[model samples]
Target: MLRRWREEDKEPFAVLNADPVVMEHFPATLSREESDALAERVEVAFDERGFGLWAVEADGEFIGFTGLSVPRFTAHFTPCVEIGWRLARSAWGRGYATEAARASLEDGFGRVGLTEVVSFTAVPNVRSQAVMRRLGMTHDPAEDFDHPVLSQGHSLRRHVLYRIRRRK
Candidate 1:
């Protein structure tokens, strides 16, 4: 299940952030301070907007996070609401990302009233791309972009954008 993040979740969340494999697609692993700040911002976004990255748990154990957030980075496609999730390395190979992301997409279209929800990952992140496909998202290769946050030569600099629109 998914719920708002709490202060107690920091340690587990930090562990998820610290894993080298888990942080592979990301530019770098987040520092403790950065993780805490991110959690705080997620919390504040939930409070202010009624939605943000939610702590995902199963049978009372922390799993990871999944939710909707507006992509703020300047990109080939900017100012789009995106559905996203990240799980621990132990949680890999499971359907958790797809499950949680499907729910987030439902919330985006049904409750949040978004016409379309987009998701993106580094071109090399086949695992995440597979999950996007399983979620019924279609990729627009023409929209692929070099991530602005990373340097030109960064391995994860190029990313592909996928989107699924709410059916009428």
Candidate 2:
């Protein structure tokens, strides 16, 4: 189930962020303080934008988050809402990300009135790319870009972009 973030989610979320395996595709794992700060930002996003990453729970446990957000960094896709997810390692392969993301897309295209949504990740993140494909998002190599937040020549700088539009 997807719901607003709660104070109790902090502990589990920190653990999820700290897990090296869970953060394998990214640059590095987040510290507890960093995790909490991110959660706070998510809350602010919801208040400011009316939509942000929703905490995902399974059988009453905080698994992760999936929803839409505006990318902080400038890219060709800047100023666009993006559907994203990050589940705990244990929650992988459970279809939670895909299910929650579908709901996010629905909300984006429905109530939020977004005509399009994009998803991107490091080129090495085939797992997330697969999820994008499962959601019917299409990719064009020409749209791929170097993540502006990363330093030049950084291993994770290269990223692939995928997009899906609201059905008429």
Candidate 3:
């Protein structure tokens, strides 16, 4: 289930974020404090936007998060809603990312009334790109961009973009 974060979720969420495998596509694993800060930000986004990356649970325990967010950094696709997810290694291969992401897109196009939603990942993150495709997002290589948040020479700076439009 993708639900709002609770105080008790801090530790589990931090454990998910601290996993090196889970953080591999990005720069680095988040420290405990950093993970907590991220949870706070996620909650604030929900308060401000009506929806954000919600905590995920399985077997009635925190696993990770999956939902919609507005990219803070500028790109050619600035001002777009994006669907994303991250699950603990143990929770992977269980269809959690795809299931939760499908729900996120439903909320994006339905409740949020967004015309379109986007998703992206580093060049090597075929796993996430696969999820984006599974969510019906199409990629146009021309739309790809160097992530603004990454350092100029960073290997992961070049990222691919995928977008899906709300069905008529």
Model 3 misplacement above 4 A: none
Ranking by lDDT: 2, 3, 1
lDDT of 3 by residue, 1-168 (tens): 879999999998888888889999999999999999999999999999999998889999898999999999888888888889999999888899999999888888899899998999999999999888888889999999999999998989999999999999
Encode model 1's per-residue lDDT on 1-168: one tens digit a residue: 988887888988898998888999998999888888989999988888877888998768788899998887987667888888989887878788888988888888888888988899999899999999999999978999998888989999999999899999
Q: What TM-score does candidate 2 get on C-alpha atoms?
A: 0.98
Q: In model 3, what are the clashing residue pairs, if there are any?
A: none
- Note the Cα lDDT for every prediction shown: 0.88, 0.95, 0.91
What TM-scores do the predictions have? 0.96, 0.98, 0.97
Maximum-TM-score candidate: 2
Give the residue spans of candidate 2 off by over 4 A: none
Each model's backbone clash number: 0, 0, 0
Q: Highest lDDT, which number?
A: 2
Location of the lowest summed lDDT over 10 successive residues in candidate 3: 73-82
